[model samples]
Target: MADLDRSSDDTSVDSREDTSQDSKLEFTEDEETLIARMYSLLGDRWSLIAGRIPGRTAEEIEKYWTSRYSTSE
Candidate 1:
C-alpha cells in the first residue's frame, strides 16, 4: 500500500469544491460594511467601488452590488 501511486500532481485538475449550494459565505463585519459603503458612495461604479475595498476586483464588486440592489427593487 505504501508504494501505490493513486493521486495526481495537478491540484488544479484534481481539486473539487468541498461544499454545496447550501454552503454559507463567511464575511467579516468590516468587509460587509466596506461593500455597503462603497455601493452607497459610488452607486455601483465598479472602478470606484473596487478601489475603496482592499483586494476586491471590479467585477466582483459590480456583481454584488447588482445582486443586492436588483432584488430590493
Candidate 2:
C-alpha cells in the first residue's frame, strides 16, 4: 500500500512537471506565422505541420494552437 501511494505520487509529480514545462514553450513570430500558414494549408494534421517547423513537437504545436486559435477561444 505504501509503495502504491509512492508510485502514484511520483506520477502526479511528473505530470505537474510536464505541464509546467509545457507552459514555458514559446514560439517565435516566424514560427507562429509558419504554423498558422501550415495549419491553414494542412488543416488539423498536426504531425505533418510539426515536421515543417524545426525544434517543435506535434504535441506542443497542437496544444498552443488549440489554446490560442480554437474557435471557442
Candidate 3:
C-alpha cells in the first residue's frame, strides 16, 4: 500500500539521520582519558561513565569503548 511505502521511506530517512548524528560524535583527549579511568573503576558501567562526561550518552560511551578496545579474535 502507499502507506506502507511511506513508512519504509520514513524509516530509511530516520536511519540516515541517526547515522549522521552518531558520526558527528567525537571525544576530546580529556574525555578519552576520563573514559579510561572511569572504565577501570566502573567496569562496563556505561551509564555511570556517561554521567561523568558532558553531552554524552551511555550508548555512545559503550560503543566507543567496544570499537576501541574489543579484539576480533
Candidate 4:
C-alpha cells in the first residue's frame, strides 16, 4: 500500500541520517574535561591514554588540549 511505502521511506531517511551522524565523532562535556585534564597534567603526551577512547584521533585530542590552554592563558 502507499502507506507502507511512505513508512519505509521515512525509516530509510532516518537510517541515513543516523549513519551520517555516526561518521563523525562527538565528545561529551565530561569526555572533553577528562581529555583536557589528562593532557594538562601530562602535557602533549596523551598517546597512552588516547588509545582507550573510541572514534577520537590522537591529533584531535592534542589540538583540543592546546586550544583549551591557549584560551585560558
Which candidate number maximizes lDDT?
Answer: 3
Which of the numbered candidates is closest to the native, going by highest TM-score?
3
In candidate 2, stretches whose alpha carbon ends up further than 4 angstroms from where it belongs are 1-24
In terms of lDDT, model 2 sits at 0.89
Clashing pairs in 1: none
Each prediction's TM-score against the native?
0.53, 0.65, 0.68, 0.49
Q: Which segments of candidate 1 are over 4 A away from where they belong?
A: 1-9, 12-26
lDDT by residue (1-73, candidate 4, tens digit) is 9999999999999999898666535667877877867765777776754875666678767766666666653
Which whole-number lDDT from 0 to 100 does residue 10 have in model 2?
Answer: 100
lDDT of 4 at 28: 78
Q: What is the lDDT of candidate 1?
A: 0.62
- Candidate closer to the true structure by TM-score (higher is better), 2 or 3: 3
lDDT of 4 at 26: 60
The C-alpha local distance difference test score for the whole of candidate 3 amounts to 0.92
The TM-score-based order of candidates, best leading, equals 3, 2, 1, 4
Number of backbone collisions per candidate, in order? 0, 0, 0, 0
Please give, for residues 1-73, the per-residue lDDT of candidate 1 as tens digits.
4334344434434454333211223345786788888677777678887777666667766665566667763
Backbone clashes in model 3, listed as residue pairs: none
By lDDT, the candidates rank as 3, 2, 4, 1
Candidate 2 lDDT score at position 40: 90
